[model samples]
Target: MGDPTAEANRGLAVGPFAHDGVWLRCALHCHTTQSDGMLSPAMLRRYYSMGHFDVLAITDHDQLTPAPDAHSEDDDLLLLPGTEISLRSPESGGPLHVLGLGVNAMPRVPERATLLETAAAVQAEGGLAFVAHPWWTGLRSDELGDLAGVTGIEVYNAGCEVEQGRGDSAQYWDTLLSQGLPMLAIATDDHHYPGFDAFQGWTMVRAATRTPEAVLAALAAGHAYSSNGPDIHGIWIEADRIRVASSPAVAISLLGAPPRGVRVNAGPHGLKQPGDVPRGADGRRNGAYPGNLLTEATFPLLTGSPYLRVEVLDAHGRKAWSNPIWLPARG
Candidate 1:
């Protein structure tokens, strides 16, 4: 990113860069009672409402749950459409999860050619597809590139200790990226239970607004980052330099900011910590800490380098990650 505002004036219309204010929020992967989940879409809204998520995608097993159709609450939260597919079954030596992002209409497969076909079907439906947990333990497969016209891969998943595109799917993505394939990387929770809501991971996308259009644009342009925690905003890239600003609340630091240096800021956490505090996402107890120390942090383009990434870690070890930022290679 350089300065979303600066790029905004250049009129390039590239990247998911955006800066117009409200915290852009979205949870790209979620399941409903329509599948193996414990609650219905209606109940799920309650959870999002209480947690204050801006948008959500209800991805059930092999099906689109027709969000807004399942709406029971009247809030500003946007309900995005989606679904999940286990490319191969437990019996066939394949079990990777593929998520369909921003599906406009449900697409069906002609026949079960294999996991490759599963991913292709989603793309055919005018939706973007991703390999979930590509290296998810027993779900590994050599058919990583079997699917055609894929949009991206899940580099990190909160539900897995060390699974997903980062392993196999990532190698495939890297091969594609090295060739300037313009592929995207995403983070998801693949949340099966409500208790595991924040467990695993998520992605922070830079968008012009918190609208559905912005979500699709961000994911499409690869202007996104993954994380267990942290929020990134106003990512701008220009003239061999990248700058970023996170929320104003949490104290954030670049455990390793781009260009190989680190930036740290001290502030209060975002959520409750002590007492019978219920954890969000991670299984660890908040402990005696005050609250979620996810306060925002900002770093300027200090090194005048061409490219780098950002990572924000919470006091509890949970953290958020941004995709690599390639400042203009030749300014």
Candidate 2:
């Protein structure tokens, strides 16, 4: 059997990994003095640029922060127009914060628009809308499962993590995926305070170029991964197995439908035999062993499994998450 094309694969949506592109480190959600953040727009730009971010979106509350008229010749950072809006959610009868990345025009919607309505407006303005910190917002998985137009969810928010213990939302992402929602996930600092909250989480995008259009197109097509730490170099979905390469990690996991997932761990006492580990094209074990670090792994794809996504956990417990690779349904 051969690898399936995306169209033949039906519900499958693999991000930029399937193609050749430059990996862009992106900070998609953040604030500046225009809103509640401490830094002004100019200062915020300098801060992220100095942090080595390739792209940034200053998503201040309820208003669009224009990108700088021109970046210095020495600065290669790409800035995207963005904003954060609070819409009323019928499900929770409270605020639902949505990040509008690449939205140049302010959306026209009612003061009390629903998530569906807000998402439509954001999309209409040529932006991608993502739900921010569902866990911190006290949103239920069922509430998000059927929402149309929303791009994805914030799987990790550093600000939320620091203020409260509700930073991770992988559980919510898994629930949506299991229900057949091909939702993408992103990690962000949700920057408010500089020294305390910045650089904690970010999304890595694979784009052919650093232009705003290319990055936005990549994100809209689900060609990105989210991480607080750790880096996913590549993910190859094959006919019967999924292969992954990443920065050195202590654990690599393939998460899917109930009871269909698998995990590989590296420890001081590694696999009983080095021969038991998969080999790479270089004819060496895919990852290091015995010293408690890993760089690559391969896992069998269970037949009839709904979807498969990867998670890489470093020694410090930080994680990187890949978007789901949906498999075609069989009779």
Top candidate when judged by lDDT against the true structure: 2
Model 1 agreement with the true structure over 1-331: per-residue lDDT tens digits: 2333233533222235543323445667777779977878877766765565666788888888976543443577777789887555545455667788888777675444454576667767767787676656444333454546677777666656443333223444444444444446787766667775454566666666778877777677666777666555545443433445543223443322222344543332322333222111111222234543433233444443343455556555555556545544442
TM-score of every candidate: 0.66, 0.89
List, in order, the clash count of every candidate structure.
23, 1
Q: Model 2: residues >4 Å from true position, as ranges?
A: 1-14, 69-72, 268-272, 276-290
Q: Please tell me which predicted candidate would have the highest TM-score against the true structure.
A: 2
**Candidate 2 per-residue lDDT over residues 1-331, each given as its tens digit:** 0122223333222456675677899998889988999998888888899899999999999998877643466777899999999876568766679998888698876777877888899999999989999889888776653478988989999999989978999887887778887678889999999899999999998887879999998898888899999988777665566667777787788888666667776653334455455322111134445454777676776556688888998888899999888777642
Predicted structure 2: lDDT: 0.79
In angstroms, give how far residue 157 of model 1 lies from its true place: 2.1
